[model samples]
Target: MKILKNIILISLFLTVSSCQKWLTVEPEDRSTEDQLFSSVNGFYIALNGIYTDFTNPYSYGAAWTMTTLEILAQRYNVNQEHTSYTLANYGFQEETAKRTMESIWNKAYFQIASANNILEQIEKRREIFTSPVDYALIKGEALALRAMIHFDLVRLFGPMPAQGGDNAAIPYYIENNRKTAPILSLNQVLSKAITDLENAIELLKEDPIISKGPLYSDSQLGGDYQRRYRTLRLNYFATLGLLARVQLYAGNKPSAFQHAATVITQASTWFPFIKTENIMGSSKNPDRIFSTEILFSLQAPQRQQTYLAYFAPDLDGKNILAPLSSRLDQSFENNQNDFRYTPLWASGEASGKNYRVFSKYNNIEDSRLNYNNRIPLIRLSEMYYIAAESAENPNEGLTFLNTIRNARGLVSLSELAPEQWKSEIEKEYIKEFYGEGQLFFFFKRIGKATIPDGKSVNNINMTPSKYIVPLPESETRHRN
Candidate 1:
């Protein structure tokens, strides 16, 4: 395996006043009406900073916590038997995980503060961005990002109390230097998220063009391809795709279905799925629905170390004959044509343990770092899945599900009823998006009954509440 590593060392802290720049203005270092937003370069810097914030390990906190949370949650479900992560071994409630959860909560709010600051500055000097189209585009992107961070905070930490939620989620800070607020109920938190997304969708509609410059090229068409790059930019469709996902999670099915359908209809005009052949080996494939098949991936220039801790026993290179062996064996039972089994499974006499390597995330070659593979924040496939699940008609939902499965070379199940079909659809999700962090949401949304981990059959107990993770002790401390 070729491990590609590129280090794009970025300053972690955003001390807005630290840099000396050509543009300087007013009372709070806020730009003037005739200043920053008037020029294209200023807009670029602001947008770049937002992108940087999203990818920062500390700033947004999605990369580390989201991925880890997904792995733990999925394993909790599939390998409930102590044979894998036994109750004796299950320690997500441990002090270490608690601290990590705290960091994630803090990091999310920090990035939101940055996004809010940008929006505030732009609004303060609205005249500089004379064209309403340009103004709305920038504002919309910021709102979308803000909404995303808020939704994550609610999902990971618990509901927010800002808009009157009683569950008391993490504090909602809409203003810069704002004090933390009391927790809100999940419903209230989601309501605010829905509002933000609606506003964002409207704003982004005013501007359709999105690109900084050329990322790569097979041949030079004009002056500098690098300076004319458009392929790497995130446009309106990408933003809407995320909106659909967040809305769906919040239980706004109609809104979710609408946005998702819009994305599906415009997909070819915006982005297409990578051809199966291209996806296998071609690293430069751009058929991904979004700029990177990643709405907000961690922009690590080079991966120095494998994130093996999140890997299943089947995938981890360090663990020999670990607990994941049996799980993989059982997971693939009777499945012959599943492509995931090959790249993600291992079984042979050459090694004592039947280990499977998840090549999906295995970026061994260093050159791949030039393109960030942090963790996909959102993808077109997810939008498609959301559309399927949110479809008002059960039959239509089945069609959407089959379309995606066919693309991945999986069999289509059409005989099942709506209720039965839902369960099967979720199972497909577990198999397809395994390590992609969609598993937990699936369980939560579907309210799947949890099975126990043990040797005795009588020990099994089903509980839906378990799917909603308990708020970390640290988060609770900040609540009251």
Candidate 2:
């Protein structure tokens, strides 16, 4: 992992404002390491810098969170032979498509390496953190960040848990140095990721970010305002929420149900569901569900550029990423009243044609933060889906599922049977997380070979080796 470690550290160091310049830094120099992680303040700067990596052009902030992965899920519409359209059809042979998929592998590992450095330093220089609470919070966040990145990488690069149970998968790099780690089984990868999250939960239970109850708005906060922004950071509930997701991905159904239930019951205190009027409001000042429901969201400084490039409905045919009018109709089960289907969509004219755009992310800026734009990575609604899908009791599952449906202004089902679950859950995931880049994982986890595309039902088969994104050519050039 020598080459991989240097790439993450060098890339991260270069982006830090306090680092002065990217050109003057050496990746493995102990002096650089000591200067960056020597104190609590230094650690804060270093940690914030890692998060900037999370929002870079190729990672969560843009392509992975909003553009490329959504295309992979067969979500967007394609008319002419554009790149994103072909990518929706799994055009791995295309140079840019292949590079985009490869970037998911590379950028994810780079962030993982950044987290590993923090985790390692947390142990070696324990005395530097004089405040025990701060120490624990920092340690917890590093562990959670490491676990979250690895979990996604596994899903992107390997087959689902049931299919790849015993198959060899990606390496779990817990250290930043050039260690000779071999590929582990899929089961092993899930286990390592879950263990880190469980540990993070332990440390974050008393996190100062949410320790005083719900975090304050920017105007109400004092003394290190960064600590007040729990939604943007990996705080207590977000860690628990991730634990539920990781457990579900690993097929620990009962554990997944329990963790999801816990988060929904507790996290509601902070991330309460938006008011009914908010969803029914005017489109000019839309109240986005993501801004309120998110457990963790990556701040997207390049949000406007991302939207205009791929999602804006008024864009020319070559740049538009809208879904077909027919596919949008099917995804919502033809129910126009559902908040996700109607208010969250807009019809805009371009080149004498109308297109259907998902306006779930219509507005990225938070009212409280003048400049911050967050792309939701996880939200409370997903927990309800997890609880519903994983519950052993059929009635309990129906209740969980109905809660979300009802919340979205749809009628609740009087009864639901276990046999009808897979399809229903599929629809809910589609409706709940549109434009949030979760549909790909949802599709992969269910081991679906063929999925519905824009009005092209079940034409995209995703089960071949091609769906499993290849490792970056540079890394597989035999560096490991």
Kindly report the root-mean-square deviation of model 2 from the true structure over all alpha carbons.
Answer: 4.2
lDDT for residue 108 in candidate 1, whole number 0-100: 68
Q: What tens-digit string does per-residue lDDT give for candidate 1 at 14-100? A: 322211121122223545424545564466455555566554444322343334444445432324332234222334466654555
C-alpha lDDT of residue 159 in model 1 = 31
Tens digits of per-residue lDDT for model 2, 137-254? 7788889988888888888776676575788777888877877467777889999999999999999977764545445453444555546566667888888889999999888999
Candidates' lDDT values, in order?
0.53, 0.73
Ten-residue region with minimum lDDT total, candidate 1: 1-10
The global Cα lDDT (0 to 1) of model 1 is: 0.53
Residue runs of model 1 more than 4 Å from their true location after superposition: 1-43, 56-66, 76-93, 130-134, 159-166, 206-234, 280-298, 302-304, 308-323, 329-336, 344-352, 364-374, 451-480
TM-score of each: 0.74, 0.90
- TM-score of candidate 2 to 2 decimals: 0.90
